[model samples]
Target: MNDYTGFPAAARHLAAMIRCPSVTPDTAGTLDYLEKVLAPLGFNCQRVTFSEAGTADVDNLYARLGSGSPHLMFAGHTDVVPAGEEAAWALPPFGAEVKDGVMYGRGAVDMKGGIACFIAAVEAYLEKHGKPDGSVSFLITGDEEGPSVNGTDKLLQWAAGKGERWDASIVGEPSNPEAIGDMIKNGRRGSLSGRITVHGVQGHSAYPHLADNPVRGLMDLLDALLATPFDEETDHFQPTNMEVTTVDVGNPAVNVIPADATAGFNIRFNDTWDGDSLKAEILSRLEKGAKASRIRHGKDAPVNYSVDWVGRVSPVFLTRETELVGKLSAAIADVTGRTPELSTGGGTSDARFIKDYCPVVEFGLIGQTMHQVDERIALSDLDTLTAVYLRFLEGWFSGH
Candidate 1:
């Protein structure tokens, strides 16, 4: 019930939360801290913990202010990536020290800042206008920076089970690149990862005729994957791109050819294809590469290889809810005087999972330092973003 009212309150909340050191999959008392602040704002906050067989159990919070329709969800995560080599930072990674108008900390911009801004905006809005005609909920999770198995996805399911449905969701994931209103991520490209292994005979490198080098086959296969463009840029998305992450022969001796070669790759695909179609296309290219005799030189057994799709496939999606998207854009313009670009160019986020439940978009602070040695954000940016969210809330609730 302490005073959690204005921009100063927001800054204090962020610094306190950062001091908790809530790294990925660890609450570090962040959820408890959030619940205390939220309860004072008349929100019924529920803390839920989810666990799966192989994934870490994650703590999550769902705080709702009203029970009516036109529900607006402010989704974000408190968990942050580890602060590697803390001595490399200008200030302590968890200290949340503000110097020359900037606050340096692990989750300052990447997300804890976003949550702080939203809370401040909500508190300010409620103080002036009481409760909105509709609803507002905070879907904060602690598993976004980890395997994402027990975070927003499960929290949403649990909330829905309790008869909660959202009209729209905004994931505060630092979507802006250079400034507060530079961009708004309306959608995200789908992500798929796989590892391909080619099996071959092991022998001395000097005896070329005695063994087949799987590396040769791997090179051709990878070339096939990259040689052709998946598609031209679509209306709402960019062309699909694939990158080879790891190429391993695991061979120790320089003279010996390894029995197998493996290459791990990840693909960020556009709306041009789904998981099934994309997988089929990849297999077709691999088959073509295996049949090619460029490096195999005439000894062709079709390049004995196998591919395993790693992890879960994140489906491509675009949020075209005109009302939800338009109001958010207008809100940004109202606050920053800059028309935010509708972008879908970044890597995947929890929005991919929330899209299935309701229309979702992303907008938050600038993200030049996320996961870097000295992650930080300008304190001015936090205030500006909080004002923008406050404007959006006012416009959205009034319109509804």
Candidate 2:
């Protein structure tokens, strides 16, 4: 077997991956390298490319070791965000340098490190337990850090089209906050975004009666949106919160009032409401604000405005499969001696798409340095995570 054949090979695998510089939407031959590593291990690897109307074409990989019941899938992406100003990094961003027993690179903790650990775990599992009774697969994509249009969502549909079904999935995202065993994300909240535009007439600043300033109307509408909370905290989720991300008038001149004003806001909601209900609530608030005479007391007409929902709504989801959660939790405790907190307190991930196909959870390396300057991972953390995954694999296939 090649040198990177078993559990101890994780760090080497990660070093090779970090050297690839596979930034968003570009695999940079990372998948090619992965295919070579998994093929000799009896995995049937299929490389697939997907494209849409305006999104970039993305390359994805699906590799399986067996075909049977209780199929377990490992999902992740190879893509990393840009390594801004490489000169600012302590080591070369793509050099995969190890200093003080820590590997530094762009994708070290954000994800490539997680993938490397899982690879080593699988290698170690096979070395000890031989072929698993059921199946194990890797569902990886290169478009995760980009538009996401041609990533896991499309890859899952494509796999399902070929009659692929998973009993459970583990997304190797950076889930831990402070340490390797800090948390495991079992659910994600729903997300909705929109832009509200208020219309008015253009006029010189000196002519107060000649123009209807949309800024005043926008303030009224914004006040209404924030006047009430979305809901109280749910059993498994925090209270729904909305933030206005941007306000734009697009007028460069201070002496002239702009013809229109727009504000963009996003809301992360819990089970208290779905996409449709949340939209209705926002519209209702805007109506109430428009009709109020506090800002435009002299104008009897309501504010002229419209709203546009942005992008697709990511529905909230929680994995309820006890066996899957219990076994993984046990595996972590076995290796780390700490009970991981089951959390649903983060932003969405590709697991949001995988949830529609099978129950999914996320666990990986600490995320303190992910997407930041000098991104790196402790060598000990890498080996620790690998051990956790190996234990999970052994327990999962044994139905223990």
Model 2: how far residue 165 lies from native, Å: 1.2
lDDT of 2 by residue, 43-84 (tens): 999999999998889999999999897899999999999999
In model 2, what is the error at residue 239, expressed in angstroms? 0.5
- For model 2, the local distance difference test gives 0.91
Off by over 4 Å in 2: 1-7, 293-297
What residue runs in model 1 are displaced by over 4 Å at the alpha carbon? 1-7, 294-296
> Model 1 — which ten-residue stretch has the worst lDDT?
1-10
Candidate 2 local Cα displacement, residue 319, angstroms:
0.8
* Clash pairs for candidate 2: none
Q: What is the TM-score of each candidate against the true structure?
A: 0.96, 0.96
Candidate lDDT values, in order: 0.91, 0.91
Q: Which candidate is the best by TM-score?
A: 1
TM-score computed on alpha carbons, candidate 2: 0.96
